[model samples]
Target: MKRIYLSLSLLLLVIIGSRAANFKFAFLTDIHITAGDSIPYNDLARSVNQINDTPGIEFAIVSGDITNIGDRQSMEVVKSLLDRLNVEYHIIPGNHETKWSESGVTDFARVFGSERFKFEHDGILFMGVNSGPIIRMADGHVAPQDIDWIKTELDKAGKEKPVIFITHYPLQPGDVDNWYDVTDAIRPYNIRLVMGGHYHKYMQLEYDGIPGILCRSNLRAKEKTGGYSLCEVTPDSIFIYEHKIGNVPTRKGAYSMTGMNYPKSNAGYPRPDYSVNKEFPQVSEQWLVRSGYEIFSSPAYWDKKVYVGDDSGAISCYSATDGRKQWSFKSDMRIIGTPAADKNVVVFGSADMNIYGLNASDGRLLWKINTEAPVLGAVTIRNGIAYIGGSDHKFRAIDIKSGTVVWSYDGVEGYIETKPLVYDNLVIFGAWDKNLYALDKKTGKEVWKWHEGKPGRFYSAAAVWPVAANGKVFIADPERVLTAIDASTGKTVWRTKESMVRETVGLSEDKRRIYSKTMNDSVVCYSTTTDFPEKIWASNVGFGYEHAPSMPVEKEGVVFGSTKNGLMFGLDAHTGKVLWKHKVGNSLISTLVPLSKNKCLFTATGGEIGLLVIDYKINKHK
Candidate 1:
């Protein structure tokens, strides 16, 4: 009998070993699967396959941004790839998934299979909740059913096992208004781990004793090093490790190389002769030295060389630092727009209501297609076609090489104030008419628009942010309202009224704190999902801020938006209190500029345009 009992005990040990070890699953984020993203879909597929092949990782999860355009086809492509990969996986929708539609709840069911999904593996329960997005994304809430289900799921676990949550947005502790995140719902659960992605960078933290992981985008992973993450979990702890091809991060903008020396300003105003393309300033006298514009779009840089577009409709390649002119393709119209730079092609739009495809190297204009209205936003490139929107009341998909219109949408007309936020082939943006639109990047079909039209959904001045999760888009309108839209169809999910948001700046959210810059000359704080948002404080900002109060810069509860006074105000990213004010004694029409990983509060006012870096002092720890 004793021998029999020993054998039974040995069998029990084997069974426990085979059970879940509380190890981490692989996490991949910001895949950016649009047509011309830095990384391709096939590459990600191979990486996924390889990750599944890795030993000990039982499952995987993607935080969001599975596709760039948020189109049905993009999801189909991604699903097809996932179908072939040998792994059990779950996901959360990011902002890119639904930028145009206000309602993003159905997207998880239609495009990604579901917005909130869960399963039990190895005695641990995993749940996913989407907060949705404010721009081209639909704000997501834990559906009444999902909320009930989470309670049920937790009850099923019964304190015997710790739960894990998967999501696209981050949630940090003691930060700015983070109420829009999963803080409320997840607070009650015995959560051991939480995972999220959306940011291109990698970060980590602990929230209320629960460890959280911020995954990087696959495309961003490739840009930095390799791609993908494999997390190993034990009953006691979770270990997440980054796997990438290269980890070198690409920097934004060109460094100053103009020789006039340290902390220099243009001695005299650059008298720009647009007719002659000449600037009369100190030093270099040549046929217009290479000029860079700080429009809405981020300039792409590769191999120490840089290319950027300006509001004047010029694609200029500069010598990165020296500001030496390499070549420029000057279009016939103003190009105060953004461009998508690939290895060889630069795709963008112009105010002439045209989409232009140019050679990336020499700035050679290869093709241009006119839509006839002011193309206020940047064009999106996927596959071999370029998708663009214009005030001409049209969205066009043009052959990148031929400049021929592949498809076009003429159904809606509004001022396309923001660049098209693409997820898959679905593109989303807001117009001046307070309408958010979603169009086919391939066929230019009107998938949907925000027709719910009410004071609640009216987005007067919302800036479009990339997808937060799979099918979410964030936009703030002039009406001081923030709305989340579904990328596939324009629908209302959740709308926040911030009558103070006259003009919108950037999209910023982390695990604990969330920050947005507006023309209000102030930054507001919503402490948690259940807490009300409060304007932490205000400042004297903006000189030309006829639109709103003053745009502030933000990261980690600190802001540095500009005022019409040509001044940059630094406020606590958390408390919204003034930290420092950099004054060049001139109006800074320029918005906000980031300088480094821990900094970016640097701002340029119009008169001085001098860079001011901010150092924040958050008081929570103190």
Candidate 2:
């Protein structure tokens, strides 16, 4: 009887080990399958066969770009090839599939079941969304309906197990126009990691607070071999391995589900109730504009008029006092960046790749200049010249009066998205190329360039606007490192070891303190008065990582910050202690505009084109 009991115990151990075996699957991204493209088809066929022959791949996920064009024939070709695979598969749409395609999402859904899907495999919840707009080409947008659908899915499965999201584009703040909205929507869910494509390069990233993994294209290109990845997921940890065609697999990396500092949903990882006794600030007035579309552009205040743009391609001017609509003008595409205003004209860039000089008073277009790609950065006007950058990887100095290019600099390799800071005869801006460049304002010549280390590149480019003050240029990057560099020599003064700061750093008017929002859901105040910067204090800002912290403005020793989660905080500037917190709207993107010592204009995205008048006189945070 004792011997029989020992044998039963040993059998139970073996059963438990087999049950807890790691779940593995293949990830193929950016296949770019096209009709008549024999090379890609052949390559995909080989990959499918190899994946089938591999010992332990449960399934595969083709993370977008399955077809080069969104056509019936193209999708059918891809479907036939994928059907030959032994393992089941899933896919999402990429820019190449939707951009410039007539059928767009319809063809993809007909062939692939749905553009967005949610499924459970090996006890892990996988969610994917079509990162493409059916109408537009080459832009990342998850439809409003998808947002609601994801919320429902999260409600059902977010608390059950670790969740993984797949997108054709990385969900970083500035990669897509409205990444913050999507991030905020998912912040309340248990998202362990996000997988994306489109960059066509492997990257390990932390956006806000969630881990992001970008996969390379599976199509063999010039000087580059095709590849895919296999991820092994256990109940507690995940390990990834990269495999190139005709080569052995290499261990990519590994991470734990619960041991990470990642900001997770409260449903999955509950925290102590910080919302207790949290009193929000009062709103004097809330005005909803008739154009009830999404607004991503920061409101530009000039001549007592608030100039802003909505996703519906309308730029409107309103009275700053009562929020009365003054004049509205329509563009061919969406306006993204904040508008720059001189005395008479307001200059801004649009997604349609055009820059416009508009009459700030009457909302009339003075002139518009066409660029090679979408112009995302705000127009910086100095001495009659408008300095702006575009997705075309060129920075052009345009004549603001005539709307013509005076000079163009094509040295940068990535898209330019930051507002150009004009300082000491140089145009300073950060680009997606992972370099901070200072160019001569007049001649468009490179004055100096600086990267983080040894000219190495980060995954996504730099999109943070550089704050130049106190002889230093303060900026942040996608790598989650914030640096303060000497403005004169372009040498690093001090770099912080923190991760997940994408917005421009906030500086105290006296330049003694710097405030930044981190990926761990906290607003930290750093002391810059010393020789080396050090963290003074960090105040928790609820859950999820906010991309942009409203350039913390200080008045009467109280610092104010608006987070992307739509929560505004009034913290003691010296202690980083939360004096009060307020939920303003769906999501806050830009810094707050302090109208007076006790009042500020807070703008947000998601609902309409209007500002919330936040009066601090009566509701001062004690």
TM-score of each: 0.43, 0.62
Candidate 1 weakest ten by summed lDDT? 276-285
Q: Model 1 over residues 1-622: C-alpha lDDT tens digits? A: 9999999999998888777444556777777675544356755876776776666677778777777645455666777776765777887767666343212123345666766678887777778865443222112222233445667777777754667687676654212112222444555546666777766766665443345667767763335344777666664455666666433223211111112111112223222122211111111111122132222233445444455555345666755445465787876554544566664777777655567777877777787666665565655566776666665676677776777887777775454545566676677666656566777666677778774335432344434433323344555555656555555555555557763454454444452333444543445543223223434433443322233223344555555555433344456665555555444422223445443323332212111212233333332232
> lDDT per model, in order?
0.53, 0.70
Worst 10 residues of 2 by lDDT: 268-277
Give candidate 1's TM-score: 0.43
lDDT of 2: 0.70
Summarize candidate 2's per-residue lDDT along 1-622 as a digit string, tens digits: 9999999999999886675678788989888877898988887887888788888889889888877755567889988988987888988888776542433134577688877878887567898887654322113556555777788888887464678889989876435545655777777666778888888888898756678888777878773557788788886777777777778888876767554446654334322233522454455345545345555555777777788876556788888777788898887666666777777788887777778888888988899888776676766788888888876778888877777888999998765656788887788987656678989988999988988743433333254656666677777665667778888888888887564565546777677877777766777777765546677887786746555524566766767676554565667678877666656443444566555534555556543444555455545534
The best candidate in terms of lDDT? 2
Prediction-by-prediction clash tally: 127, 2
Best by TM-score: 2
State the RMSD for candidate 1: 24.5
